[model samples]
Target: MVGSGFQRLRKSPWEILSSAIFSSILVVSSQLALAMVPHFFPSFSLVSMLPIAGVVFVATVVIGRWCRRLLGVPASAPAFVLFNVFFLWGVYICIIRQAVPSLLDAILNAECALLLFGLYRIFSSDPGMVSYDSSRSTEASCNGFSDFSQCENSSLFPRVRYCTSCKTNIRGFDHHCPALGNCIGQKNHRLFMVLLTGFVIAESSYTMCSTRYITRFLNTSRVGLEANLSLNMVISTMLFSILQVLWQVVFLMWHLYCICFNIKTEEWINWRKYPEFQLNIPAPAQQGSAFSEIRFFNPYDKGFVGNIKEFLKPKH
Candidate 1:
């Protein structure tokens, strides 16, 4: 299923599992962490796991509802929590256990930090909202687009749209992202690309490091209660990383194509509604043809290089 917002991204089973794990870990004490238990002692992982799961489920539901009521940024908190969980686990569990080498770990952690920073920028930055002018309200009303900030002298902001979720008019509006709790628009679209690329890189590195560690552990160690518990957690992390990397990479490619074509995700979906895409350019004429056909054209297309340059240097 797509995420519960305008992102239109997949909600993989691994994502659900990660959210559950994060929620459970958050509600449960640090003592619930398998790492806290001494290796020499009898493992209490089995004993502690069930209660943690149950308590976390209840806590997650309550917290989710509370956040929705107060923040109005659906799924943002969970996504933030999941990112922190991965970083914490990578440092505390994977790095400490030598799953990743020092040099490689340093690079991976830097990428993780970059991803976090990009997400922060997306969440905090203005998305090129078109300021409403009461002076132009009469003109807007006359234009039959009073609800939007696009009328009369606002020919420059052709793709402007009123986001119901944000209660504002966004310039070059693409979509609302529940994960980042922000709208993807002219100002932050490039940042979104950077974030997506960083995510794919970081996730791929994490998956590789996790796979190396898991393989090494399984080959070298004997099966024991404590060992089994640790292995299970690592395995789960690897699985989540794999699933997320696969999904996000595909999403990244799709966005790249849109960028190349100078087409917003929203515009692509509702092309017929936009006058910019209504260029009825005629097809080639034939010698005995009774009629010529018109093909749809994107007026905003400035060729691939020009489109990329425009995206990188947006008019903000």
Candidate 2:
């Protein structure tokens, strides 16, 4: 007998349960950490989490709205953003106190959210095929034709091209993401990069501050009422300063290389792009490349040694 008025769930019950369980665990762990940790550790604060929470909530809402739009549903970005902000602020106050580590954790959490969102987008998208349709060309007489003729026709899934894992077409293709998920093609590319940049800045700043604090802590000496700054602090500070300088120089060089070459992270994974996309752009990849064109670099790529070589490679 056919069951009337019964609809099959689009998402599995176990999947929903797992998601809820994971979210609960994240909240509980964060709350416990905040409660147990000393207030001195900056990560225990509401202020530290605010920015990250805001970014995560906003990005999630934006992606949801985008999905709805694609499904022919009406949605407003402003309303979603506003709602997310309010909810995020509430979570910030309820979960953690203002502290540096807390702030860093918030940023990390936001990055995780973005990564998950990107992954979801990649899986949900349709796989598009690459093909050529010369019949549609209105040009009567083509004085010139090149090897690029095969790229004349757009892929069936115009937003996505090569999927690295499956080595096939990706639906709703945005771009490839290594940090969050596999790729950020069509759907979640914008949100992924936006959150990623924010995460990088937040993480870097936190690391810098923590290193300084650790140096100061190590340098402190137990002295009588007349306490003087120890030489150890001075040495630690000098070492940290040099390390920081070197880190920044390396980072800036890599950024410059990406900008000049017009390469996206996805290109590294699959070496695919639209026929119209060009590799000779002057602006940095992060700053100039469209959301769909940017790619994420793998951090575990030969421990900075290989990275330097890759960054210095000429754009061809």
Point to the candidate with the largest lDDT: 1
TM-score of 1: 0.69
lDDT score for residue 210 of model 2: 41
lDDT of 2 by residue, 1-316 (tens): 2212112124466654544444444333333333222222334343454344344434544554455556544332222222332333333333321323665657645654663454455444332322322442412222222212223443332334545443434433435433233444433434444444543453344345444444454366444522222222222222322333444556445444443453444444444344434343345666765544333433224444564454444322
lDDT of 2 at 263: 45
Per-residue alpha-carbon lDDT of candidate 1 for residues 26-113, written as tens digits (9 for 90 to 100): 4343223422332323344433443443444445557655754574332445355445546445543543348667888788778777
Name the lDDT value of residue 73 in candidate 1: 31
Among these predictions, the greatest TM-score belongs to 1
Give lDDT per model, in order.
0.63, 0.39
Error of 1 at 14 (Å): 29
